[model samples]
Target: MPITEILSYGFMQRALIAGTLVAVLCAILGVFLVLRRLSLIGDGLAHVTFGSVAVLLLTRVGAQSVSLAAIPLVMLASLGILRLTDKARIYGDTAIGIVSSLGIASGVVLASVAGGFNVDLFSYLFGSILAISPMETWIAAALFLIVLVAIALYYHDLFAIIFDEELARSSGIRVAAINRLLVLLTALTVVLAMKVMGIMLISALLIFPAVTALQVARGFRSTIVIAAVCAVVSVVGGIFVSFVANLPTGGVIVLVNAVLFVAAYAFRRCKE
Candidate 1:
């Protein structure tokens, strides 16, 4: 099928628009998380989204509202991960692991109690971007703008904290606030991205683009730009390929990102 024919379908149009927006969001936030070694947080929070979706499913919430409602619940879980690290004296990965385990466990038990997974739950598990509603697309666009603006406002503080929290704090950067903000933003992005990449593969969207950019980018700003471009390309390319091949869009998108990473790594080595 020609690209123009594919773009003629409304569902395809929605998928492209929303997927691109969420991909860019993940790429930008992934840079900060990757630099700080908090990339796992995306995976961790993705599990939390699963649990949150399970709860919403159990309540029989409308499909459209589930994403919005999951936002706060997952945000709270993200903060809990932060608290575990700060007050419980746990390592960051351990804290993420604890929260991740709890989230998946809750979802599993809930699934069992609810008489196993339903189609709705499965859609979220693996993603259904081609079925994204009009409202969800607007949500993606709105949150994309909000997060982009927030990052722009806090870029310097985030940059400082990513390199050295102690120094950023000593420099009067309000390390705790910035840390919370970062996690909160990440949580929001993860929830929004669940539709684009699903619970199982969402972190790839966050990690791959940013890391791939690091292999070739010469500066921080350039890294962000490159990552965003990579993510957008993956989403667009993945959607078209998946459409033509009748494959899962989310999986194809991740594979596209993986291919980019390998190519970037090879290029970096060749340069060296």
Candidate 2:
């Protein structure tokens, strides 16, 4: 089928728009996340998002409520977890590992107890790029706006704080506050993308493109710009590939990102 044919369907169109918006937002967030060495944080949040979705399923929250109510709660919880980790002087790495296991366990147990919610549990697990709703499309757009503003307003502070939180705090940056904001934004973007990207591998969408950009970028500004562009390309390409190949949309998108990262890393390694 012609690429145009994919966009002709209402669902396909919605998916495409949703994917585009999410691809951009996730890429930008991933830039800072990577710079801050918070890659595992993305993975943990992904699991938490899955757990939250499981709750929505168990609670019999209407489909619309999943992204709205559950997502924020998950984000807030993630922020709180981070704070607890920070304040307790627990290593973030260990905390992420602990949190990830608990979050994913919650999802699985809830799934089992409910005797399973939606057969579309597979879709939530791996993402179904073809099933985006119009409401999801709007939500993604609004989130992108918010994320972009946050990035612009806090760019220098974030970069500094990510490099050295104690130093940034000493220099008058609210490192703790900024970290909270970043985690919340990350959680929000992850939720928005969960429909198209799926919880099972949504972290790939957040990390891979930013990773690819990081390989070639000389500085933060260039990295963010390149990551955003690469993300758009990956989403559009992955959607089309999955459509044509009849692959799992989330897996296909993540596979594409994986291939690109490997290729980029190889090229950079050879150059160095």
Candidate 3:
């Protein structure tokens, strides 16, 4: 089908717009996360989202409200990870692992108690981007703008912290506050991204484009731009290709990003 015909459908339009916005958001935040060695944070937050969704379902929250309700829960979990790292003196990965395990376990127990997953829950688990509502598209746009503005405001501090936190702190950067902001933003991105990439594949969306850009990017700003471009391409291409091939949009998007990563790696090797 032609591009115009595919985009003529309302669902397709929503998916394209929402998916692109979410992809760019993930890619931008992902650059910081990957460099900070917090890439797994996305996966951890995603598991929390799964558990939160289960709780919401059991509580009989309306399907339309589940995504909105999940934001605060996941944000709290993100802060919990930070607390574990700070007060408990746990390593970053170890802290993430602890929270991630708990989140998934809670979801499993709750799911079993609820007599198993429902159709709505399954959609969240595996994603249903093609069925994205207009409200969600608006949500995506809002999230994108918020993240963009935050990054602009904290660009220098984020840059400093990414390269050397201790040095950033010495420079009066308030590394702790920046760290919290990063994770909180990441939490929000993870929650919104559940509908685009699903809980299982959300990490790939967060990690792939950033890593791919790193393979070839010349500077930090360039990396962010390149990562965003790669993510946007993956989302747009994934939506169209999945529709044509009758495959899952979330999985296809991840696969597209993986392909981009491989291609980037190959290009880097050839250049070397």
Candidate 4:
């Protein structure tokens, strides 16, 4: 079908909206994830969404509704991992690594239980961004607004903790509560984006644009702003490429981001 024919379908419009919203939020949450040095966790949780999708499928529930319902469960499961790790001696990436393994393991079991060969499983694993619907768009939009408000309300504390946890604690930043909120936000973003990039490439959607921004950004605000722009461009460009090349949108989006980074790096060198 031609692009015009494709646009005639409601799914495509919803997909564009969903992709744009997820890209924006991922770009935002990713800054903190990168700052916290837990980029792998972002990837891991995304894969975890895969498993959760699998489990939800086993229940024979609807795919569109499953995501909204799964958001809280996924958030709780992620938070549970954090709390468990916090109770023990491990901190930082090590803890995330442990939880990631557990989440993936659980997801596999759930997917298997749902059916040994649900074709939808493949789509969930790799993503089917073109199939996004109105509900998914709304979900992403609402979550974006919520995250925006939360960040605004706690900007200073979040910055303090991101910059230095000890200093944040010394300044009475409520580190634990803040950390939980961040994890929850991360999980929420993952759920919304899991549809577009799927479990496999969602983390790239989160991290790469922020990295692209870091190369040219002078400060935190500038970095994130640039990243958001880069992210939107990557998503829109990748989706277009995916439509034309018949490839996965998630992978293409990440590739575009990588290309941008290389371009930025070369351009900076030329100027220097």
Arranged by TM-score with the best first, the candidates are 1, 3, 2, 4
Q: Who is ahead in TM-score, 1 or 2?
A: 1
**Top model by lDDT, which number?**
1
TM-score for candidate 1, please give it. 0.99
Q: What are the RMSDs of all candidates, in order?
A: 0.7, 1.6, 0.8, 1.9
* Clash statistics: count for each candidate: 0, 0, 0, 2
lDDT score, residue 105, model 3? Answer: 94
Quantify all predictions' global Cα lDDT against the true fold: 0.95, 0.82, 0.94, 0.81
When summed lDDT is taken over every stretch of 10 residues in candidate 2, the lowest stretch is 116-125
Instruction: Residues 1-272, candidate 4: write the lDDT tens digits.
Output: 68788667787777778888888888877888788786766776776676677777887779778788778777976787678768887876777777778778887777666657477778777888998777777877898888878877887777789999999999878999998888888888888888888788888988898788877888998888888899999998888888879988889998999998888778777878
Give a tens-digit lDDT track for model 1, residues 169-199. Answer: 8999999999999999999999999988889
Q: After TM-score superposition, what is the CA distance of residue 119 in candidate 3 from its true location, in Å?
A: 0.7
**Any runs in candidate 4 off by more than 4 Å, and if so which?**
1-9
User: What TM-score does candidate 3 get on C-alpha atoms?
Assistant: 0.98
lDDT for model 1:
0.95
Model 4, residue 4: displacement in angstroms? Answer: 6.6
